[model samples]
Target: MEGIEGGGIGGYWWWAAASSAQLAWGINFYRKGYAGDSRFMPLKAFAVASLFVGATASAAVGILRASGVHSVEDAKEVGASIRSGLGIPRRARDE
Candidate 1:
């Protein structure tokens, strides 16, 4: 999938979260591969990637929905607490 562009705050956070997840999965798969009962496969990898994307999108959407936010700016405000908690840099959410 096309990732967010220009390394916006949200985009950067998404990359961090997704990359971390992918890295963890890679480690898990490597370990499993050495275990002889590995279930790591291309389809499983795809599924994991899909799940990560879905989760990130859902989280952003959910924050927006929960806060009655209808725009990027609104999303920024709504995501403030979370973004701060995650140590993501603050930026104007408005495009």
Candidate 2:
């Protein structure tokens, strides 16, 4: 999909910014929960992990878009390359 422009913080940058904000919020909540009580620890931990994963994925997409990897195929290739670099095995896919 084409990125939205003209307005402030439009396009892929928006995703990155939002993701960063979410990560920050998650961390804050996690710290607060950790310091306050042990009952909410699991929920807080889950939130932090979820946000972190979202941020990572969003960052990757932002980087790919910024690098001119517009097509879906190109994005997939880039993801595969990253996975390979991280020693993650690729699953078989029907072309």
Candidate 3:
């Protein structure tokens, strides 16, 4: 009820959505777990974990894009001179 306190609506919304999604997925997974299929548990676990990780990464990318801090390309450019300064090994002319 306190209007816009501490991170405002955007932060709270993002946190709530992410957490609810995680809880729902966890419940559904446990409820449907295999009853002796042997390979089923491992397979399902992998799939669920992959889904969670992919979703989180996508959300992070979205936030970064919104902030206009797109990629490592900019950081790489800044460090390029340092990288080059380290120098690559040269082959002997006889080869």
Candidate 4:
């Protein structure tokens, strides 16, 4: 556990790739699934992608904030961005 040195930052890249893949899959699934077959699969894939993106952004923000690199306003902006980007309700702001 001391000399291990292959899982530092590359893990982020894998998540990114998987997220993108899920997003694409969702879109394609939705498009081809418009024939009224199964609607849940597309939504599931899309939600998974959104979750990954949101989680990554949140983690980054936390890391930055903890290191004295970001301000409170940044967190608010990120929250707003995530909500708007995901087409979520905008009236749920805490401020």
Candidate 5:
């Protein structure tokens, strides 16, 4: 769970690259009319949604890493604090 400050460049780089590639693929599929075809619409939509989620997660992780949050636990704490600040309800964890 090493972050940017911990020299975890490869992990973040991979996440960014993968997210960009997935988003591009999703956009390409939509532009090619794949979404217009009923058979392909569902799959295309799912792909696009998945890509967006991935990209969002990656960006969040990058931000947290850049802010000196190095471990997963620390990231979770920061996220929780953010959610609380925003008046968002915390999810129940099975811990």
Candidate 6:
């Protein structure tokens, strides 16, 4: 996979901008929902917010991999860091 690293700077900017827009729209949806402006919008508001969160977190890890964390051990350390940060259960073989 190319890790969203193509198209040079423009592509990176496009991705960042798009992610920001998605998050903004999600927040707007939540605001409108809580304010009772839309009766059926609260559920979708959570979905969109989670989507943005997942996408951004995934993108950050992808970026670290693409930017030259090449060695296997380095990758493992990165993974461990991620697991720890996310409070994920560590494997028995974890370092």
- The Cα error of candidate 3 at residue 84, in Å, is 25
Candidate 3, RMSD to the unseen true structure: 9.6
Each prediction's TM-score versus the true structure: 0.35, 0.55, 0.43, 0.35, 0.52, 0.42
Cα lDDT tens digits for candidate 6, 16-81: 565667668667765655544576566776687786796686566445544556468877888888
Q: Give the alpha carbon lDDT tens digit for every residue of 4-95 in model 2.
A: 42233346777779778877877777666566478877876887889888878887777766676778887788889999999988878825
Candidate 1 regions with alpha-carbon error over 4 angstroms: 1-40, 72-95
Query: Per-residue lDDT tens digits of candidate 1, residues 1-95?
Result: 33332223443455456556655765665455543334656666676667666556656654444445667776667678788899987777535
lDDT of every model, 2 decimals: 0.57, 0.73, 0.57, 0.57, 0.71, 0.64
Single out the weakest 10-residue window by summed lDDT for candidate 6: 2-11
Per-residue lDDT over 1-95 for candidate 3, one digit per residue giving the tens place of the 0 to 100 score: 34233323443455446755765685676677666778677887887776577557656644544444446875454356555677843334413
Q: Is candidate 2 or candidate 3 better by TM-score?
A: 2
**Ranking 4 against 6 by TM-score, winner:** 6
lDDT of 4 at 16: 51
- In model 2, which regions exceed 4 Å deviation? 1-10, 33-39, 75-95
For model 4, what is the error of residue 51's alpha carbon versus the real structure, in angstroms, after optimal superposition? 1.1
Provide the global lDDT of candidate 5 against the true structure: 0.71
Show model 6 residue runs off by greater than 4 Å: 1-11, 34-43, 58-62, 69-74, 77-95
Model 4: per-residue Cα lDDT at residue 20: 58
lDDT tens readout by residue for model 4, 1-95: 33123334433454455545655655665465444447566876666567556556656644454433346887677878888999987875465
Off by over 4 Å in 3: 1-27, 30-32, 73-95
Candidate 6 Cα lDDT to native: 0.64
Residue 26 deviation, candidate 2, in Å?
2.6
Candidate 1 TM-score versus the reference: 0.35
Candidates 2 and 3 compared by lDDT, better number: 2
